[model samples]
Target chain A: MTTSKPTVFIVDDDASVLKAVARLLRSAGFKNALFSSAQQFLDEHDSNASGCLVLDVAMPKMNGLALQQTLAAQNSELPIIFLTGNGDIPMSVRAIKQGAVDFLTKPVNDSDLISAIQNAIETNQTTRQARSKLHELQQRLATLTPREREVLSHVVSGKKNKQIALELGTVEKTIKVHRAHLMAKLQVRSLAELVKMSERLGIISSPLE
Target chain B: MNWITIVWPMMAASILTLALLHLVVWFKQRQQVAHLFFAIAALGVAVMSGMELIVMRSVSIPQVVLLMRWLHLPLLVVWIAIICYVRYYFNAGRLWLAWTACYLRIFALILSFTTGQNLFFSEITHLKQVAIFGGETISIAQGVLNPWYIVGPLSMVALVVFVVDASITLWHQGSDTARRRAIIFGCIAFFLLASVGHGVLVHTGLIHSPYLVSISFMPTLFAMSYELSYDVLHSAKLAERLQISIIKREQAELDMQTQRNALTHLSRVTLLGELSGSLAHELNQPLAAILSNAQAAQRFLAQENINLDEVRDILQDIVDEDKRAADIIQRLRLILKKADCQLQLLNVNEVVQDVLKLVRSDLKNRGVTVNSNLSNNIPVVTGDNVLIQQVLLNLMMNACDAVADAVSIEQRQIHIHTRWNGTAVQVAISDQGTGIVSDDIERVFEPFFTTKPQGMGLGLAICRTIIHSHKGQLWAENNNECGASFYFTLPAYSGETI
Candidate 1:
């Protein structure tokens, strides 16, 4: 997908700064998305896209910090890197506290900004990956029948079919049938894979051990 | 009466006319009490002289006695009025002595009516005709003097003492007017004593003539009038002198204020001149940007696969950044322009940005990094835009100079901060460099004080003056770690609108 190449969304009120920064990123082989204001970025941004935001701190209407808060409120995984012409210690501290990837002053060094953008994009991808994994596991868990889910949970806890059937007040053959269905639903081939999948889903912190 | 005897009455008439003229002057300026008293004394002398003429023409003892008795009336007034004249004019006298002389004259008047013919003489032995100049003859009374008649002479003697005492006191007090009064009244007293001696001798028949007391008083009266007129002229001269001196003092203060303003303006102009080179480089920044963008667009257009989108953006930035550089030059020109001080409401942040724009190229060239921490929502400040811009430029350029000497490029930093503190907006520029020497911190604002080579040293001094004229304050202090921080404040304009 085009998403494999990370996009840097830049929002700055100064057209010259926006142009210069876009040119720098384009030369550095980075995909650039330019917006003139924070509101513009919010209005047009694709929430499902995995990328990082490069925002100017002193924009009119809505500033970088305010945008950081809005994105945070929405549980957006988009990492934000702040750029400002007049950066102070307190402002950088506040931005960092709000989970900003980096706070840089204007006329920023190209390598510094590029590395920070790279770091932010990597973090966004890592967070999205983990979220999608959990989502996939939840989807699989949702498809299982109630009896099959109960049978699967006991089996993944290192219980044998005999032990699971005894706990369910059922025969071993009936427990075996429910386990087969749940394994197929979860798409796991072996007991070890089933345990590993359950662990990935955060159904348990660890297998029976 | 002989024509010579008529001389005394004519003299009395002239003296009366002179005194009346002075009385008219006194009426116009009633504040001079001495004039009023001098006129009264002169009138008394004139009337007494007339009475003496009447007594001299009497052909019998009863007639002479009657005329002499009435003559005591003016005699009483003459002594009392002259004493009052001395007191008011010189403002110096023994009150009791003057009162005693007056009371004795009053007693003499009482005896003249009560004892009748025994008033100034116990009895008149005979009346004799004395022939004089012009073949005119006048009657002279030969009388046995009453012992009690000594009262009149004694009072005259006391009157002389009062005049002498007042004159001496005036002399000892020692001012120009006092000395003049002393001399004037002193001569009057001398003439008065001689006049009285002549009158006494004539009354006792020791000399064959009429009493000439009134004529004797004329010189003293003239001197008193002259002194009073001199006092009026002296005060008028003094008033004129004071008026001239006050005008001169005000002019001198105005000149000093104007000079101070000129010095402040000159210092600002000189600072702009010194920063001209850096300011040129500042303009070059945007020009270089525009050139690079245009060249890059030309290269893009020539390519077989032309990137029109990138080329379009490049051309647009060139135009915009060129305007940015033009804006910087415009701000620099504004400060350097010669103009009168015009105060207005200004946003301090905008002023700060203008200063930074002019100095940006200089900072980059010198490897100095600047960080600004301007607070949002600062209120408008009241100041002259050009003058305030000059102050900001001076501080920023000074900051760049301060950071140039640091050990490393990374250590060379200038921080510009601003905040709104309720009543005023404050701007602080701090640098990380060699800090100011402890003793030189306060002296930095003094004219002609400098640590840098080739520095005129009026920069900080002018900055302080401009801020002070705006009813603000500017100061500098060394930072704990390194370098120094300079701060200034401008009062917030509180009007509803600019």
Candidate 2:
């Protein structure tokens, strides 16, 4: 998580379109990158770059939808905004369903493209933040001992120390000690906060009857 | 003058008139050999009538014999003419039979000249004056009949058989003119046989009568004249009908041409409709660029510290994009305009490149690539520019559709080739799609024939008509390995100032 200005990565097979979109983004005081084709974007793009993708839907090979699928397979968090010269209803619907932030037709209005880019960048930022937070939580969860991990699950499931100890064949004193250690390792002070952290990490199920 | 003198000369004069009439007809239309043969036959008949008149007035055996001796010459001429006339007019009859009849008649003429007083008599005993036509006198020869006289009757028999055979064949041909001609020939045959039978009876003295062979042939001449006159009248009517049909056909052709032009315009509009999205994209690229550049320049202008150099670059780009958009519009207008055929000298390669530019984006969108091999030194062709462009555009669009579903990128290529082959400029467009169905190759150019589900089937038909009107030819053939190729040739302008 480096703090930097988000770049709008624009991919279009048409050089003029790519240049025009890049110019518009630059005029809007946003940093931007340009790729002439989907293959070029795939080959040259920086996966670690903090950005939203502005893609042309009708590219020669590996079109916008295919690129979207590829990035999704790679777990890339870059939000996509589609720009197509001829956007039909079914195509726009498919793009939207595939998690595109916006499907705009060309000659796109400057305001609409800029707003779409802004929304896409905002989404990317939120998604990136949540993903980093989850990563940090997983790192912290990995440091817990097996007994402490079991106790954390029982605590998150709304189990009492006595019930946890009964399930684990331990005394209430040992269960309580494990709960404190796991909560401290997870950096949560209150029981509710601990449960929330466990849930974030997907540590265990909630309490049943 | 008595009846024999008046009537015989009148017969000669009438027969000579028919001969002159046919001679003039043959002179005007030399291809009518039948007319020429009929003229000769009538002339011989006229001469025979004159000789019979001389023989009928003869008072001595030597005079009658001498007159009868040369009369075989006219008879030989008549027989030859009849054989040739029947062959030419009816266009039937056995060749061997006709030749036999001619040779036999010639043998009789040679015998009459060489060995006998005449073909019918070896020697005349006396010249007998007979009063038969109400006190008019004519001569009858009492003679020992020439043993070879049977040759003349035998020849007549052969001529009659030949004519009857020809008439029957002509009748079997089953046409109006042929049936009429056959009936006329049948009457001539009967008259010829009757005259020959009468000549045989008179020569053998079976009946007491002056020789009337020349008079007996008059009916045959009349029948022939009737047939020939019928032909002349029928042909005149046919010529009139032919002229009317020709005018009607030209009118139909003009109407067809007008309809075709309308259809061509309609199809061009339909093609534009199909390509509207691509053309919009084409125009939109420049427009989008211009908008973006202008907006970007506006933003720069709005800045407190304006970047003059950046603004200048954006303005330049805007101008370039505007020109690009204008070019696309100009092309669209050229294609969309409806006009008549205006032939002018055009560089084929330039038109090809222009059409390729128009369809470039559409083809790219469909993932089809076009490769061109154009000869630099090819001669200019004469044609309507927009129509030629339409042909090229239609073919390229069809090629794009052909390769739309190709499995491989390599198979999605269209090749356009142009060359100058001495007299004409030839252009060939080939595609690596599924080659046309073998049976459909020729039918592809026929109107309303199509293989595509959404096709109007007039594209190739119109293309062929356009090419043909330019004095060019269009054809299609499947490539040896795969795909199909369409070829067209435009005649090269010969530098004639028109």
In model 2, the Cα lDDT at residue A11 comes to 92
Candidate 2's C-alpha lDDT?
0.87
First chain TM-score for all predictions = 0.88, 0.93
Q: Which candidate gets the maximum DockQ versus the true structure?
A: 2
Q: Each candidate: what lDDT?
A: 0.81, 0.87
- TM-score of candidate 1 chain B vs. the reference: 0.60
Among residues 3 or more apart in sequence or in different chains, the pairs in candidate 2 whose N, CA or C atoms overlap within 3 Å are: none
Compute the lDDT of residue B252 as modeled in candidate 2.
100
Which run of 10 residues does model 2 chain B get worst, by summed lDDT? B128-137
**Candidate 2, number of clashes:** 0
Which one wins on TM-score?
2
